[model samples]
Structure formats: C-alpha cells, structure tokens
Target: MSTYDFAVIGAGISGASVAFELQAEARVVLIEAESQPGYHSTGRSAALYTPNFGPPIVRRVNAVGRAFFEAPPDGFAEAPLLSPRGALTLFKSGNEGELAAFLTNGTERDPIHPIPVAEALRLAPLIRPEMVAAAAFEPGVTDMDVAAIHQGFLRGFRRRGGDIRRAQPVTALRRDGATWRVTAGGEEISVATVVNAAGAWGDAVARLAGARPVGLVPKRRTALVIDGPADLDLHGMPLVEFAGDAPYLKPDGGRVMASLADETPVEPQDIQPDDLDVATLVEWLETHTKTSVRKAPRTWAGLRSFVADANPVVGFDPELTGFFWLIGQGGYGIMMAPTLARIAAALATGGNVPADAAAAGVNAADLSPTRFRF
Candidate 1:
C-alpha cells in the first residue's frame, strides 16, 4: 500500500486548488467522481470576479488572489484571464437603509461612490431611467476567467509530479491509528491526511468518517444568457445588482447574462433552472430595462453551499486530527480561490494562518468543525 501524504476528495475549484498547492510539497492524489474534473459547481459558476464583494474575509482573499488571476505562472493560461467589468448596486426609492449598508460596507475596501440616475444609466445602459432612485458603482470589478484559473492550478499540480485520478468516487474510509484507508474506483489507497473539499456533499463525507456535520446548506441559483442589443456598446458596463437581489444582468460580449438572483434551498445534485424562476426573471428584466429578452440562448443552475453564518470553513477539525475542511464557500469560491487555497494549505501543514487573514478578523474558533461535536 502506497501511503501518500495527502488525499483530496472532489475536484471542484476548492479541492483542485488545495491539491494543486499541496501536491508540490508532499505525495498527493487529486480524486474526482465525475468523468472529468470541474464538472460540478466549478463549471457552473457565474464567472464573475468582483473582489470588493462578499464577506470581509472573502474580500481579503479576493484582494490577494488578484495577482494570480491577473498574471498566472508561465504556460498556465492561453490568454489574459481577466477582463475589466465594473459593478453597480441600485437601490429603490424607499430602501435607504439597505443602500447605506451597501455603500458603507463596500467603500471600506474599494471606493464605492453614490451615483445619480444619469450616472447609473451611463455605467449600465440596461438600467431603466425610471427604476433607479440611488446607486453606487465600483469600477474595479472584472469578469473572472474561471476555466483558465482551473487549468492553471491543474498545470501547476501536474508539473510538480502530482497524480490526478478522475471518475473515482470515494466509497469508504477507515482509520488505522493516524493513517486513513480510502477506497475509490475499486482501488484502495492510504494517506496521512484527508482534505474534505466536497462542496455540497461535505456533510455526507464527514458523516462517513463519523465526523459531525457543520450545518452546510446548499442553495440553487439560476442564470440565463439572452440576446443583447446589437447596436449598443456594453463593453465596459458594470454589473448592475438591483434592490433586494430581485434580478441582475451583465453584458457578455454580444449577449446579455441575466440572473434571477434566487437562492432556493435544494439537495446536492444536477441543478436545473425553474420555469417560474425564468418567468419571474423575464418579468423583472422587462420591468427594469428598455431592451427585452424575447428568448434565452441558454439557461442553467448551480448549487451554492453555505454554513449558517455564511462564512467559509477552511481549517482542520479539532476532533479529527487529520480531516481538513475546505467547504461552504457559497458563491464566493471562484473569486476567493487563490487566497483560500494558500491559506488552507498553510493551516493543513500545521502553520499559522496568514497575518492578513487574521487581520481580516476571521476567528479560528468560528471555522472549527468541533463546534458541532456532542
């Protein structure tokens, strides 16, 4: 039996990224159940890279991850991975409280300034002239190249002589003292550590190891690609987020990408867009914009898993010495991948979390899986 140093289950952005980072230092194996890697949430991402978004810890990760996204290592990306696309947050006439919090929370990390109706319309041509009472714009947002980032991590992992095993679902786990026996794809393997980056199926994997659940809930979010205005120039348009997340749209080349911004709780499985959601989104879009999407080119959905507090859990279990967690990233996984992976690897190796992450005020106890222990 080849006793490897680390075994990462699941090949989503979280798993692949952690494996990619740790494989260089230890004998590692990256395992995935799908026929290929990134078939789950990674492939189904909205592919946006707004750093000044998400929780404070997430924002810190996004800020640090920008370097890797902007300039990947050699032979990792075919082209530039980021294209500048700013963001606009629109508030209704009566939602002053929500708008104030948004601006206050946002401007701390990046300059988020209130814009008038004319300014908002100029930033996002799709915003209806009558729907906006107040708005804020963050000009530093960009559309992330998720595919390129995934490939870059894989390339780096492979370059360091890491082994990737796809179509391998881990069926069982047995602990022998400090070592772990992992069975996947009819092959038994042994490893010193098991990193659980299973995304929505995280709790189940922990249960298999007799570890307690961490209160992860998977929610479905749907998105659609529709016909954009042929004559309109939307190259530098900011991502317009409407009040209460009712519906939002961003320009994608000649097409427009619209989302209902719905977070319907669901089981972990192949996700599909609901017809009612589609109808609601279309109605909202028509109500908020002059350009109507008569039909959609594509519509799809993905699960975004979150803990009760909506914070990512990325550390080792206090009870289970060798089981590390990298789950509950919600929709912020892609934007926060670089920093999360690096931090996760450091923690797994028994090193301290970065000073920046600590300064971001992420409490170590808040991320521990032992909180659920009876």
Candidate 2:
C-alpha cells in the first residue's frame, strides 16, 4: 500500500543516477533485480570520460557532465572521480585518411592532435611498429572510477530520504486508473510515474508495461585481460586502439586489457563471454601487441543497448502518460549519465529541459522516444 511520486526500474547506473536527481523534490524509490546495484554493465565497465567519444548529442551531454566529474556535489564522494589517462588512436598505413577526418571533425573539444609514429609508440609501446602508420593522441581522456560515481549517486539519493529495494525484480507493471501499479519481489507499489532505465532489457520492460517497443537492440561486447611484457611499464601506458573500428588495448594493473570491440546483436539476459569472441580477441591482441597467449586470459561480456538511430531515447511516452523512457544510452551511458539524469528528471516532472543542458546544445526533441514512432 506504499505510494511514491516515482518508481524507477533497474538500479544500474542509468536508474540510480536519474533516481538521485528525481528524489530531490519528490518521493522516489529505486528498485533493482539484483542484490547489489550496478551488477551488470556498470560494474564491468572499463569506464573512461572522453568528450570526443560517442555521437554529437552524447558529446553535448558530456559537455555539461564534465563539470560534475571534475567536481561533484559536496560529500557526494570521498576522492576525486577522475584520473589522468590519455588515449591514442593508431592508423595502420591505409587508414591515415580516417585520422585526417577525425582531427578536423569539428569541435576543438576532442583534445587530440596528430602525433608522430615514434611518439605513439612511446605512449603505447606494445603496438607492432610494422603495422602502425599514423596516430592521434587525446590528452583530455581520463579514467573514471565507475564504482565511486555510482555509489555517490546512490548514497546521495538515500541521504535525501529516498528508498531502494534490492533483489526486487519488477514482474508486472499495470496502469490502475491514474496510478501505476509496479509489482516487484511479490509486492506492489503505486506511483504517479514510472521511469524505465532498464538498459538492455528496456524494450522487454516496456512490453511488460503494455507499451510499444522502441526497437532497442542489445549488443554484446567482449573484453579480456592478458599478461603484458615484464620489461614494460604497463601502468603508465595510455589507452590504445586502432583507427576505424578495431580492438582496443589498455593497461590494467600490470596486465593488458583488450576488448574485441564486437557488437553482436543478442537477447536481453545475463550474458556470458562467447568463446569465439575471446579467441578472436586473443588473436587480435597477439597480432597488435608484443604479447602472446601462453595461457587462457580473463574474459567478460556486457550488453550495450541501442535504438535504430543510435542515439539515446529519453522522454515521456507519447501514448502512456506517466511512463517515461530513459533507456538506449548505448555505450556512452556512464560518461553521459550526469546530464542525461538532469534532463530526465526535469522532463519527467512536467518541466522543460534544464538551463545548463539547454546551454550545452541538447535538443530534447532529438532524444524523445516519439521519434521512433515514425
């Protein structure tokens, strides 16, 4: 018989963040299926805050979000959220043209400049010298402490008198007159509004609520960690990736963390790392780096959900009055969470986009779920 102003489904990064923003002025409850928050993508994220990444709208969201990462709210987190770590994009001979387009790709916010091949190797000494042709380095990229940021939002949300129900999987969503009855863990709660931030399972959750699917395709991405050269200072190395769509390698502790960069379409569920993906990644790592796969490496996979347009869908549903969509963040969820949370909180409460978000050139219409109807 408990009632709340809002019930946010999925206590992952997306849900936890937006719930924190919404609980500021309204009664809010965060419901999670897992016993712990961020059990999926958020926990597994090799997160980096690079403004140059993602599409234009996501970049704008990062524009507004950078300040938050730079200096979060007082008492939000104990330590700084960011660590200095650069990114290097390698061009293997024929791919120099791609680097050319990227440099002049508009907006000086990228923090990347064309670097000599020698300089690129100095930054990431593992790439095969025979294969590298040209390179670009992004000095503005930084490693993000995903856990701290997620925990900060959750802590702040709870500090503001918000409730969080862990291990509660939302089984049913029914509209009772003007109220939304959300059933989770065999208990039902009525709320004036429901915000769906279920990530890869977004469309499924919408179907459960009797809303139309927004064409969300959950894609699985696999990453692995392997041994690095003993003489190399892997700790100080920059994140390295090839030009165009290719596997990426970075330093994790004393080992090299490499990603297959594969986006295979998949169903929404607890995904496991595909053996073929791991094998393919090992081959790529051996070919790209100066390392060999002497033994099996550690591998994991997570889902990145995207809509047809490859941009995030965030707004009130056109047909369902109180059902809001804050899903489809794709791979840019963590970096874009801060501003997206602000925008979602504002839009769900019958308010316009916040001033800071507007100044960042975020067109709310561009992210509206209604765009999928056409």
Candidate 3:
C-alpha cells in the first residue's frame, strides 16, 4: 500500500492551495472526484478580490492574502494574478441609514470612501440617475485570475513531488491505529493524517470517516451574462452593487455579468441556474438600470457552503484524531485562499500559525474546529 504524510481530499482551490503549502515539508497526496481540478466552485467563481468583503474573520484572511496577490513568488505565474477593477455599492432614496451602516462597517479596516452620485455615475454610466441616492466606492478591488491561482498551486505542488489523483472519488475512510485508509476508485492508500477540504461535501466526508459532522450547509447562487453595446466601452467601469441586499452587475469582457444575489439552500452536487432566478436577475437589472435584456443570456450557478456562524472552520477535529478540517469558506474562499492555506498547513503539521497571519489579527482559535465542538 502506498503511504503519505497527509492525504487531502477535494482538488478545488481550497484543496489545491493547502496541498501545495504542505508539499514542501511533507509527503502529500491530493485526491479529486472530478476528472479535472477546479471543476466546480473554483471555476465558476466571480473571480474578484475585495479586501473589505465578508465577515471579520474573512476580512482578516483577505488582508493577509493581499500581499501574496500583490507580489507573487518567483515564477508563480506568467501573467499578473490580479487586475485593477474598483467596486461601487449604491443605495436608493429612503435607504440612507442602511447605506451609512454599510459604509461605516466597510471602512473600519479598509479605505472605502463615500462617493457622490455624479462620481458613481461617471464610474458606471449604466446606473439609473434617479434611483441612486448614495454610493460607497472601494478603489482597491481587483479581478482575480482564478485559473492562474489554482494552476500556480498545482504547479508548485507537482514541482515538490506531490501526487495528485483525479477521477478518484473517496468512497470510504477508515482509521487504522496511527494511519488512515482511504478508499477511492477501488484503490486504497494510507496516510498519517486526512485533511477534509471537500467544500460542500465536507460534512458528508466527515460522516464517512465516522467523525462528527460540522453542520455545513451548501447554498446556490446564480449568475448570468448579458450582451452589451459594442461601442459602450465598460472596460474601466467599477463593479456595481445595489444597497440593501439587492442584485449586482459587473463588467465582463465588454458584456455585463449580473446576479440576483440569491442564496438558496441546496444539496452538494453539480448545480444549474434556475430559470426563475435568471428572470429575477434580468428583471432587477432592467428595473434598476437603463440596460435592456431583450434576449436570453448565458447563465450558471455555483455552491457556497457555510456554517452557522458564517466563518471558516479550520484545524484538527476536536473528537477525531488525525482528522483536520479546512472547510466553511463561504463566498470568500478565493480571496482568503492564501492565508487559510497557510493556517491549515501549519495546524495540520503541528506548527504555529504564520507570523503574517498573526500580524493581520487572525485568531487561530476563532477559526478552529473546536469552536463547534459543543
């Protein structure tokens, strides 16, 4: 039987990043159910990196990961990982209080300033002039190349002698004394530890290993692409989001990528966009802006799994020996990948959290699986 120091399940961004981080120090094996890596959430992400997004814990991770995106390591990628693209959060009349609250909370750690309606319109002319009463601009937001980031990790892992097994869905897990026996694709492998980075199937994976479930719930979000005028020129526009939990629209290759921002609970599987959700997105777009959606648009959906507190769960399982969890990233997985990967690798290897993570105010205890032990 083949043996490794660690076995990481799932080959999405989360799994790939953690495997890459651990490969240099440990003999690691990455196991994926799909035929290719990043066939799910990672591939269908919005691919945006906003430092001020998500909850407090997520924000801290995002902040820690920013340095890596700004200046990647030598030969990490042929092209830049991030491209400049600002973000604007708009509010309509009678929603000033909500907008103020958003601005206050958003600017606490980042420099998201309030912009006048004219400036917001100048940044994104698609907004209906009469509908927008207030706007907050985050100038540091950028478009992330999701594929490049995932590939970079895979490359580094492969270069460090890490093994990756695709089309091998983990069917069973058995704890045998000091090692774990993992069954996938009718083959078995032994490892000293198992890291569950299965995203939406995190809880299911734990159950298969006879470990307690962490109450992970997957939620589906739909997005669509619409046609834009050839002469419109929206390459320099900021990502536009309506206030009070409304839909958002972003520039996508001269077209518009719109979403109703719907979060419907779902089972873990390959997801498809609902017709009603797409219609809702189009209706919201047409009602809020001068843009017209007269034809059917390209649409898709992805799953974002979350726990009760909406923060990530990382570290060793409280009750199961040699089982580490690196799940519950929610919608901020891409932005938080670097820091979370570092944290997971350190914790799984019995090492302390990175200094940069501590410097960014990341409380290792807060993200540990122990928090959900009770």
Candidate 4:
C-alpha cells in the first residue's frame, strides 16, 4: 500500500495548486477522475481577471492573487499568464441600482469608475446608442491564460515529488485509525488527510466519504463565439456587458464571445449548452448591440459550483476527521486560485491564513466548513 500525508481529489486548478503548495512540506498525491486535468470549469473558464467580479472575500483574494500572477515563482511558467483587457459595464435605464451595488462592494484600490454613456460608446463601439444610460469601466480587467496557470501548477507539483493518479474516479472512502483509505479506479490509497477539490461533483464526493453534503449547487453558464461587425477593430475592444442579468460580450480575435449570463441550477454531470440559452444570447446581442449572430456559432456550457452563501467552502470539516473542504469556488476560482491554494495549504499543514492573505482580507473562520454544518 502506498501511504501519503494527503490525497487531493480532482486535479483542476484548485487541486493542482494546493498539491503544489503542500508536496514540498509533506507527502501528497493528486487523484484525478478524468484522464486530463482541468477538464471542466478550469478548462472552460472565460479566464477573465476582474478584481471587482466576485463577492467580498473573493475580491480580497483577487487582490492578494494579483501579486502572484504579476510575478510568479521562478520557472512556474515561461510566458505571462495575464494580458491586458478592459471591462465596460453598461447600465440601461433601470439597472443603475446594479451599478451602485457593484461600486459599494469594491475597494478604492480597484480601478473601476463610473463613465458616461458616450465614453462607454467610445470604449466599446458596438453598443446601441439608445440602449445604454450609464457605464462603469475597470481598466485592470485582464485575460487569464488559464491553461498555462493550470499546467504550471501541475508541473510544479510533479517536479516537487507529488504523485499523480489520473483516470481514477474515487469510488469509496473509508477511514480507520487516523488514516483514510481512498478507493478510486481499481486501487486504494492510504493517506492521513483528504482534500476535496472536486468542483461541481464536490457534494457527491463528500457523500462518498460519509461527510455531510455542503449544499453545492452546480449552475450552468453558456458561452458562444459569433461573427460580429466587420468594420470596427474588435481586438482592442473592451468587454461590454449589461449591468443586470443580461448577456455580455467580449472580443475574440475578430469575433465576439457572448453569454446569456444564465445561472441555472442543475445536478452535477457532463454539462451541455442549452439551445434556448444560445438563442437567447443571440437575441440579446441583436437587441443591445449593433452586432448580429450571422451564422451558427461554436458553443459550450460549464458548471460553476457554489454553496448557499456563494463563497468557497475551505478548511477542514468540523465533524469529519482529516477531511478538508476546498470546493465551491464558483466562477471566481481562476481569479482566486493563488490565494485560495496558499490558504488551503496553510490550513491543512497546521497553520492559519498566511499573513499576506490575512492582510488582503481573508478571514479563516469565514471559510471554514463549520459554517455549512450549522
């Protein structure tokens, strides 16, 4: 039997990163159900780095994460993981409250500021002149090279002597005498601790381990790439979004990537894009912008898993021995990966939040799995 200090399930960005952080200090193994790591949300992410995007704690994590992305560990990645891309949010007549709500949560450190509709039109030329009333522009928003980030963590983990078990679906988890026997694929692994970074299948993994489900609801988000206006230069265009629950558009080369911004709750499974969602997005684009979906576009859907409070469920379970929760990252996982990974590693290895992360506004107690129990 191969024995280790910890077994991290799900080799997405979360698992790969935490494993990278923990392996140097203790023996660690990363077990992935899929043949390829980051096959789900991590792979499907639009990979935008918007500091003002997530909830409060997540925004804080984003602040802390910026340093790591700015200057990653030596040899972590060859090229930069972030590229400059601005985001512009348009508020039609009734959605001014939504814009206000966004500003209230943002800190002064963020580069987001209100702009006039004319400026929004100047920044993003496609918006219909009569459709927008006000705007908010955040110049700090960037495009993340998610694949590079995911692969870098994985490579670092393996280089640091962490074992990897791919194509291994965890079927059973049994604990005996301070050791967990994780049966996945055809073999069993003995480890002192288990970290559930299973993304959308998080609650299902918890149930298999005899731990209480943490109410992880997987929400589907559909995105499509469509040909847009041909005359304008879309390359330098900012991400244009409506203030409320409307579709958003981002320039993709000469094309545009559009999403209905739908958050439909569903059971965890291999998700597919709904036709209605794609159709709705097309309608929204035509109504809100000067662009039209001229042909059948490439489309896909991915699940963003979240708990009731919509923050990540990190830290160890209060009721389960040696079982830690690193799930429920939702749509902010990519942006929060660095800070969250460090936090998870620190907590798993007999420490609290790192000083930098703490200063950046991460409260350990708030992310504890104990919250879900009560």
Please name the candidate that would achieve the greatest lDDT relative to the true structure: 2
lDDT of 2 by residue, 1-374 (tens): 99999999998999999999999999999999999888887877778887887888888898889899999999999999988888988888788888878776436765578999999898888778987999988888888989999999999999999999999999999999999999999999999999999989899999999999999999999998889988888887888988775788888888988888889999998889999989989988888889989988988998989998889999999998799999999888999998899999999998988998898889789999999887
Candidate 1 per-residue lDDT, tens place, 191-277, comes to: 989999998999888887767788889999888887766767776777888767667789877667888878999988878899889
Kindly provide the TM-score of model 4 when superposed on the true structure, using C-alpha atoms.
Answer: 0.96
lDDT comparison, 1 vs 4, better candidate: 4
Stretches > 4 Å off in candidate 3 = none
RMSD of 1: 2.0
Q: Clashing residue pairs in candidate 4, if any?
A: none
Residue 369's lDDT within candidate 2 is 94
lDDT for 197 (candidate 1) = 91
What TM-score would candidate 2 get against the native?
Answer: 0.98
* Overall local distance difference test of candidate 3: 0.89
lDDT of each: 0.82, 0.90, 0.89, 0.89
Candidate 1: regions farther than 4 A off: 95-101
TM-score of each: 0.93, 0.98, 0.97, 0.96
Candidate 3 clashing pairs, residues 3+ apart or interchain: none
**Which pairs of residues collide in model 1?**
none
Backbone clashes in model 4: 0
* Candidate ranking (TM-score, best to worst): 2, 3, 4, 1
RMSD of each: 2.0, 1.1, 1.3, 1.6
Query: lDDT of model 3 at residue 267?
Result: 92
